[model samples]
Target: MGGGRWTVVLDPHRWLELRRFRGLYESGAMSLREIAKETGLNRRTVAKYLSGRTPSAPPERAASDRPRRRVVDEVAPLIDAMLRAEILLKGAVIHERLVAEYGFTINYQRVKMYLQEARPRIAEELGISPGELAGLHRRFEVVPGAQAQVDWGDEGKILAHVGIPKVYSFHMTLSYSRDPFCCFTTSQDLATFFDCHRQAFAHFGGVPMSIVYDRTKTVVRRHVAPGEAVPLHPEAVAFAGHYDFDPDVLAAYRPTGKGRVERQVLIVRDHVLAGRAFSSIEEMNAAFTAWVPLRRAKVHGTHGEVIGLRAVRDHTALRPLPQSPYVVAQRHLRYVGKDCLVAFDANLYSVPAFRVRPRQLVEVRATKSQITLHATTPGAGGETLLAAHSRAVGRGARVVDERHWDGLPTGAGRRVTAGGDLPAPLQQRAQDSSSGSLMALLNRAAATQVEVGRRPLSVYDELTGTRPFTTHPNTKETP
Candidate 1:
């Protein structure tokens, strides 16, 4: 017995005897000697336990209850501050920063253990549950085709020469199957947004009944009161109408509502973009396409079913696409410049000469590779297509149709090559009209001023005799 504390492993028989003895003693049917003899423990040990004077807890717990002293204890306040600053930072990162900046000499495990105790306090100070404050997310599943999640990820600068261009990936994932489709673009504009949707639907073979979206301006026009229905952008409403899908917007500041897509975005960045270099957007998308099939073939973590097999079930419940594919073009009102050209995407497309007047308001519909200019009001038929040009990919490009400018005239008054040229006789007249008209007019004026004129002012003055006397202002006229 080391210092009267015998740490012995009692057999089951000894435990049974202890309980029986304790029960008999409690009932006042056994003496201390008898109980001790029956239990085989010393009389003192039995008295220690029965008197409620045993060690307050197990020996190990007593040793563990004392606060652990560590090198980090010297900067306990700093650790608390780090926790307050960013609760999500792991102990390894905190330790790294402390060592690098504060010269902390401590192991990572000690910091990790300390953080476990400090986090709940920090969370309490912020008036939130530790779980909520720590962003503990719950997993959710929806019926196949019932919902899909859409989001955009900033991919940093890729095609820098094309413009220090920031690329973004548009990701849409079916919630049930975890099947994801991604497209990369240089913009997040409404046109690009809808274009990605079209591409995603084509890739998936159909559209989900509803698409979950964060409060992006492309979907929600503006923020509204809590619990109120968010107002959808007009273009978005039209797009949803065309696709026959409901737009489900997540509450502001809640990203976990669409965690599947969020997770898939990280998955793509890790598996596709990480440590990979691509010079073009097309290459990135092609890589994604090739990788998608392999990803689908693997068993998903949440569903425990092969993603591709699950997707087969997902596709059956999806809404069918409309007969004619939705025309996803951006329409902008453009002014026809005096050059008989309409400016679009930094390119010029000529309208038929005399067909559209300069400064005329025209609607320019731009698809990925085509630009179509239309008159605001329909002609005798329907919307008049004044011009259509293959969309130029480069800036300052000119897509001119020489036939469109046929009605325009050449330099001076010569008509261009009913090619808007003046008549042959009219050209001859125009050629001579400038100099000939001026010379003929001058000769007529000279003839009119000839000295043999029938009635001159001087002749009339002489005939009258009195008016010829000194009419100059400097000479005084006699009254």
Candidate 2:
């Protein structure tokens, strides 16, 4: 054996054997041969061992005791207790605790070495160790437009429908590229869930190869068995099927498995979705659609590349958008009343009275610029349409039903003098009852003005003057 020391960890018994042999050699009581035979060591080797020499230790044993501690006995218990309590077991915290509580006066790293001896304990406390964590990883690849991540971000609220409060915002992201799709959503219900997906797809301009969703109730129903399987929610499954992409779900309590998507949600909340105010979901989405693509045009932190350009390159892998968005929200069915009006949201909206039937399924769309209604029927399951209305408010003759003669209320007629021949709304002369009213006075002025041509001051002066003579002789000749 090349010369190296073997640590004698057995309590002084083994050391006593060597020492007694040394004693025999010093006292001249026994030969090295007798001592070596009794101890089962080569006589020369026993001589060397007793003489304070060493042999190589086994590899596993050597690694463990490599860093000898200055104060292992003094601080070992304290390190054990700290780890048991799950206190953060960094060297600094251990050192502070040792000095403050246990009266340890050793150097900080002396405490560190003691703690290092107790490393196995601390690693167990942190759930997965560095080695385990490193091994339990997944390699995520983005097939460009083929895979994206969706999640909810921060929420906001405002008056959505009188007393009803709406969620202000949530976040969605692309998995492969770290691209974000974010917007406001009033609910995590099926309607809003699919709507957010619609907006996200529009934002990304394509579907992903697959989408990864957490086992949120908004997406998954319930686990069939603990750690076994989770049933995808009916609505979410239908939506995924409609999109024609594979649906991937992380296990029930395994949040770390989807950390990539979770991180994207946070980044979008911090950068894209927060600190903005919007009046309605539509308005919020409009803002998001505009803002997100411009953000994509900029560079990314992860890839150090332009996201928009990359997205363009990746888009070929995605499925084309459906001709129409999926509709899962319940719609109201009502009639255009005989008065050519249908009331919704505390406002009277008129549809073409004749074109609407008594129990027609009509879709009412109240957008920023207009309010419209489309009649729906069963044969095409809302494919066949009947009539539509141009939304009107403080009307200047807005057409509700084409059959109605005057579609607008009085306020509307009062605002327009579309034909200049009609009297203006502000200039009514009904209060003037005198024969010398402005009309009568205006008649006399007209007679003088025709004779005076454009000499308006002369006509006014002649009419107001005490003199009654008005007509010139050249003006009367033709009569």
Candidate 3:
């Protein structure tokens, strides 16, 4: 209302009022000046409202002519490159790489905002659908006993009070029935892993046609890139071969591939382990074993059938187990030390001295409860069992068999014998030497003997190097 033009901001309420006044003016019921006077507003403002043009509609502000600046614009190409390289790269990782490798000074929030717009566009260009990138996987069903999914659950420190540092749960679920079998173990080593598989197979009474598993080191020899042929562990291959089942190694980071067992891992924790204190892995396994009947009694949510009934079908369709289960062992090459001992698992086991030489290479085949040492070279007795010992429970223990040290010197002018006694010749020689020494001692002590009725006390005293005490006759006591 000053000399210069000023802007009039029209809120919705004020705009509605102006529209109502315009309606009245259109009807010729009120003059513009009269409406302005009644509304306590300026005449020109009311006239503008009454004009054919819609004055209630705010005037569009002219767009700014200055160029816009965005901090992320400079790094757009770098971000695109990263997205192209790894479609699932996180915005935080991109921001970190930008700051570290590309000298980007922008903060993480800005990078995250840019990713919100850029990720989908890049994914589309790369022909990856949004649903796929968002972890959408189709549900699948397998025929009874056709497949099983395996996964591991890490139960950290759950049994630490029982001296176990860590505990792991091994889960195997029949894909069709969703019947789960889980056991608790302290190790994921090759032997223990396959041993658990054996236990599961026994529990089910048969093996599936194929088993789906993650790229665990116990199953896979090493991790290969996507689409590459996965190199399986030698023991794993042998196990599968023996069981007549194929091992289906899942893609990296794809838990959905083994979703049945992955879900079973959680289900078991909720049903069996939650709020329960277990003293040992066996007790934990026993808890799962007890829960299995309850689990099988209920109708499965996905399959819509009693789990036990479905499992019956699955067990029927499975391949019959072999007469004897495959012996799963982790094999390693170790050199026998000069002491005729082979080192394994931080413990030393004796090898027969006649069977193995010092510095000889031997194959150590270890299972959960036993260690078997074998001679490696043909000249040294090809693949012969050198020694077998129970596995040491703790580290740094030396497990030796006295028979293994028979040929070695005893450092007492004799050699260790098989029966843990001196040899006949050595025994005779020892007896003769002892008898001669006793006779020479007696001959020397004869000069110190006194002529008494029996072996005199003076002779004994002189030989034993002690002074005999004497008492006076006048005293009442004798010594």
lDDT of every predicted structure (CA atoms): 0.77, 0.59, 0.79
lDDT of 2 by residue, 247-333 (tens): 788766666666666776555443433333456667766765665655676687777889777767666667888887665442345
Q: What is the alpha-carbon lDDT of model 1 when measured against the actual structure?
A: 0.77
Between prediction 2 and prediction 3, the one with superior TM-score is 3
Q: Which parts of model 2 are misplaced by more than 4 Å?
A: 1-139, 156-168, 273-279, 329-479
Q: Which candidate is the best by lDDT?
A: 3
lDDT of 1 by residue, 1-479 (tens): 44946454545544443554455567776667755554445687777666665444322211355553444577678878876765655565567557656887665645675687787888788776534234677777789989999999999886676564689999999998989999999878777898899999999999999999999998888999999989998888988999999999999899999989998997887666754568889999998987787688778877899999999999888999877766667789999999898888778888888688889999998876688989999998775888888888768999999998886776666543412444477556646765555333334443344454277688778787756545777887679
Highest-TM-score candidate:
3
- Sort all candidates by lDDT, best to worst: 3, 1, 2
Question: Which pairs clash (backbone N, Cα, C closer than 3 Å) in model 3?
Answer: none
At residue 338, give the lDDT of candidate 3.
91
Q: Report how far off residue 343 is in candidate 2 (Å).
A: 19
Candidate 3: residue 260 Cα off by (Å): 0.7
lDDT of 2: 0.59
**Model 3 agreement with the true structure over 32-52: per-residue lDDT tens digits:** 876665445567766765786
Judge candidate 3 at residue 67 and give its lDDT: 46
Candidate 3 lDDT: 0.79
Which residue runs of candidate 3 sit more than 4 Å off their true CA positions?
1-135, 379-383, 414-479
